[model samples]
Target: MEVNIEIPSHFLCPISLQLMRDPVTISTGITFDRDFIEKWLFSCNKTICPVTKQPLDDDLSFVITPNHTLRRLIQSWCTLHASYGVERIPTPTQPPTITHSNISKLISDASKSPQQLRYTCLQRIRSSIAPATTRYYSSRCKNIIVTCGGIQYVANVLIEKDATRREKEEAVFILAQMDGYDQEFKSVVLRNDDYADLFIDSLVGLLSSESSSNRERENAIKVMKMVYSVADPTRLGSVEHEMFAHIVRVLRDKVSKEATKNALKLVVELNPWGRNRVKAVGSGAVHVLVELLLDERLDRRISELALVVLDQLCGCAEGRADLVGHGAGLAVVSKKILRVSHVASDRAIRILSSISRYVGTAKVVGEMMEVGVVAKLCLVIQVDCSSKTKERAKEMLRLHSRVWKNSPCIPPHLISSYPTN
Candidate 1:
């Protein structure tokens, strides 16, 4: 029979409401479990003490201090109740101290040494350094790691043919986490053309690899987005067609909502560059986006992004043909006109305008009317939307008025608002 012993209320962490293991005292003199407090301050990005609600120091390293007295008390209590199904909490081992010099040397050795040494270094980083240190000193550690050429080292590990699966996953995690620190790290990659190509190629390989996990592919997509954000027009224009194909594949898979959005954003980023729009079209982006839009459960921002990409793709003849060719393309675009946000509505109108202005063959125009697009245009002119959106709608209506003005496809209610000119 297990004896029931109530844990002392005072011995519990204030945040987690459990007996404190590795108890630590904050600057506010409040005791909490180290893991809980670190998660609160670091992972949650909180700056106020949970108990006293006092402001914490900007330098978090000084804000948290280990409470040896409280820890021993809890340990003794656990020992006394060991026979009653309680286990004594062992003293916590100190995390290995990481300094800038330590990181710099580790990166240097990894970069210059043989593959064995490089693997060992990666192990040290993944096990001892990143997880142990990131919990308490994430911001400071990111700066140090980036300054010590950690990005390049990790990228090399990701692309290394002989790297273990675990090591490559760790590298992907590090690269994804290391972004958004500062532009200095990105600028380094951007300035070196050969390194940039290798890095991009590795990421594209991951996206295209069947063996790569969804998490890995998502991280790779994130890193690609960051890289392209800072890439010059020359570099963006020179992106390989295979990369566009893999990106379109990501969209079609709907890997994750965030990954999908990043994929869309990546296409938008590259669309304006030389031949990228054509590349995207050849990769079947238009068909994928139209399919994505047909799903009614999409997020508002996603709808906006899809519309935006479609609009950009339509700038090219190939993109326009793809949209007009899809069975639901015109219908989906017309359906979103007033059903989504103002931005979405505007982009939808722009797509219609593009189709009407360029590809408005008699058969296409007749199909547009049958699909309720001609009616949607009349509604846009009547509704309280942006002036620019209203103008585009009016322009499309006037351009097609000769054919649609007296057409019965438009409802009588919306006919009054149709552009007369």
Candidate 2:
């Protein structure tokens, strides 16, 4: 038979009715677990202690000192009842404080401390920067971190003479984490004309630096992606040529799966701007994307992104020319149309549409016929693709049917099914 032992009511938090972990005293002279009280105070915004009904005040400046005596007594009771599967509570360390004021003070202290103390402070700040860990605790903390100069402090650590590689990586990682959690912070940085370029330039420098680790490079790209996501068209138009080159280089280097995806996204996001598209074409992004498409082991999501980018790039004459110029480009794009997901298929068909409509010289037309693109279009109509996609395919085939149908490059059987515009 299993036996149950009663936990002393004095050892239980009044709010939770569970044995307290890290019990703390409020101004009401009542003790509750630190986690419960904090949530009540900060998240629920309650001014009174749960049991005493005493006012905690709007300012909430009460010190939440640990009740060591109660904690020890709880541990003793657990030991005495060990036969009933009772376990002793481990000693509790300080839980993360969710207040914005505490967060601002933390940032200020880290920024002003001496070298050794500063590093310690940076570590403390780093702990609070985790989105996965701290996001549920407070949104206000994220605001404090950004508005209180925390980001600048972390960046300064990267340039500090005595900082170790690990510390530098931590700083970069913290910035990246902040970007993930805080949308308001992202908007402020991108919209701030004084800081946007300088901030991006620093990330680019870190991405290009020989001494930065692979992880650091990943963090840099992540931060770059977040910044670019919020930047307006006018601001994006202001991006320099060297920045595109670095982005292309990161894609070429294949830093990580995530890094590569973000780099591709950054390129596609910028391609809508004429100047950015020209810069990307100049950086050989077309060739790099085509090469990535040729990889048999590429993840489906990665392939989808690659095709999406290729479709965007093909909007410009230069992008279309690059696609036609590569030896396997037309054939590879045709192969992907029906084989991949609906989005990839749509993007692939659009790329073929661009080539057929805008750049369809006799030779390019002949090549499309020979590469099975015409047959693929016929198959698109027969398949269960989206109506919009089927319409595009039919239009592409009709646009070049005259040149393609009579040519020996097209198969005799498929030619009869070709639709004339």
Candidate 3:
């Protein structure tokens, strides 16, 4: 026969037992609830323990589901419950209907899941909602995170947990993906210029990250370029110099031609020569740039990028001085004037004009001319090079070289008819 207790519904609330409300304990050892204590104390011989007079099992925890006969059996046992762990078999108790606060707390905790799976869930929710709907969610992210702390929880987990190096990199990429379009993203980008430097500094830190794959590093660098595009100097700062050098370093190491192309594009945007500024460290960057000029392994994309950077540097007085001090780059470029195809040769000649005439560079050109770079340049002008190329080369070689002294600054076409080199 089924025996049951008609325990009132209100008595089911563990908090409302006239015992404790909003009960909380950070400690793991806080033992039995008040109900259990009361039950065991009053159970007498009817149950092994007042709180828990049922037969004990080795299971450390229990879960209930509507389909389980055991859950029904446990409910029958609850009517005779005693608080202590050992108990005479007691009738099952009815499970209380869940309440709103409990539901809220459950959701909060679920939302705060620290696993990648949790973010997958959040991303799904975020994508399913309308733009306007997400506006509302935008405000709720903080409190919701606090309750269950999902994104925050994930952030903390990512920051604090021991993940594989590859995992950490994926985590960083995920962070970038998530934060890129946060509706509030522009306020910081637009609201204050000073923060742009901080943002770039942070991105630069990411570029140096070990274990980051080629694709990921390229994306990070692309982000820096894009950020500067919309950024007003008022908001993003005069970071052109720092940005340029870092671009060079990335350009130097980047395996993808596209990365090199993109870097070149950014340098060109800084117009006429972003390279010459002190912060760009004309003194430092020019040497590396020149070395690149000498490296034939560098493609036209890289060479064009270097030229654009040189042009930018020429615009700055300090940059000009820096190149002037590094005469070797121009000397090498001048030497190439003889061997390069028309495209690269003309480009080389133009870059020489771009950075030539600087005081320090003039001396290097002087030494190079003294070493016979001029005759090599003139002989090339005598070859199948374009008229425009020859004209520019003649003008440049004439202006920068001591060897070309008193030599006619004749255009290559005009000189072609009469040259006795």
Candidate 4:
């Protein structure tokens, strides 16, 4: 007869509910399997204890101590139950604990080492340390890494001509993960014109590189967005055309939703300075944004961002011409007026307002009338949209009343609310 052996509930991990292979106790005084807790804390980007529901420190120094006593008990239980087909649990080997001092040394050694060793060190920093430290404990680790000169080391790797492809990718990945958390660091980079230019040039090179992987491109764009957010006005005004081209390419390729959103945001950020609007128009941003909005399945946030970019771009003559020139541009912008969120509606109205106010030639006004944009504006006046939006709609109607008023395109119900001014 076979004997059934019941496992003790206390011997199980709180998270996995399996026999603990390598039990570890968290700061909350709760024991869980090491793998399970690490996954919760690092992989899931969480900082709370699963069982206790207490907030864990957002510090990399927060330690998960090994529960050797519980591990031994679980091992004994498995050993005693060997007859019931339970295999003896082997003792788990602890990984070397990573410390700030060791990380600093590693970065220092890599800084002075040959290319191969440098790559290896960067790989370790990216794969092992950077993700865990930067993802959750950004505020804490940002100061530490910045103090260790990690940022400069990584930037050097990116600008080094002899650096291998993997080395550059890893460097960008680490820099992207950092995400410009330290504003002081950003100020310092911006103050040094040469360093800032070289760093940005390397990131743009990644964006424009055909050999770059999708992940690499995504990270590079993220870093670029962060860098440009705090860039000085002079630096923003001088943004290279190639950078805009690559950003538009990222938008067209739709590398990922995050990448697309960041690219749109980058365009919006840069458009306010110098000839960036023209550069974006030259890079085909208007067409790409219009095409993106035409997709019915695009999420609300992306739609809003796309419209926002279009609104900024439409501030310039080149932008207005490009938007009106695209086949679906006016139609899509009109369609989003009251259909998406308030922000989207606001931006959409602003785009039309720009076209009507500055570029409202007879032909363009007719295009707006034919595309049902006139109807949408009429509807906007009667609807419960923002007062600002309603005013803009009325202004557009009043601007082109001679052509759009009493036009057959305006729905009869909406024509009554059309601005008579």
lDDT of 1 by residue, 1-421 (tens): 1547899998998888988888888777788898888667643546578998776633222246778998898899898988898888988766435567777777776676534345445544554435445555666667677777777788778777877676677688777776575486576667688888877888887888899999899888988998898888888888888999999999999999989988999999999864999999999999999999999999999999999999999999999999999999999999999898999999999999999999999989999999999999988888889999999999999998999999999899888888787
Please provide, for model 2 over 97-149, each residue's C-alpha lDDT reduced to its tens digit, 9 standing for 90 to 100.
54556556655655555342454445556655555454554355556677777
Which order, best to worst by TM-score? 4, 1, 2, 3
- In model 1, pairs of residues that clash are none
Tally clashing residue pairs in candidate 1: 0
lDDT score for candidate 2 against the true structure? 0.76
Candidate 4 lDDT over 1-421, as tens digits, reads 1246677898889899887888888767888887787667653546577887776643222366778888788888777877778887778653424457756876776676644256645654664445544444544555566677777777788888898787798888887777656585485456589888888888888988888889999999988898888887888899988899999999999999889988888887898874988888898989999988999999899999999889989988899999888888898999998898889999999999999999999889999999999988888887788999999989999988999887999888887888777
lDDT of 3 by residue, 11-60 (tens): 23242343221112111222223334323222211112222344211211
Point out where model 1 deviates above 4 Å.
1-98, 105-137
TM-score computed on alpha carbons, candidate 1: 0.75
Between candidates 3 and 4, the one scoring higher on lDDT is: 4
Candidate 3 weakest ten by summed lDDT: 56-65
Q: What's the count of clashing pairs in each model shown?
A: 0, 0, 41, 0
Could you tell me every candidate's TM-score relative to the true structure? 0.75, 0.72, 0.48, 0.76
- Least accurate 10 contiguous residues by lDDT in model 4: 55-64
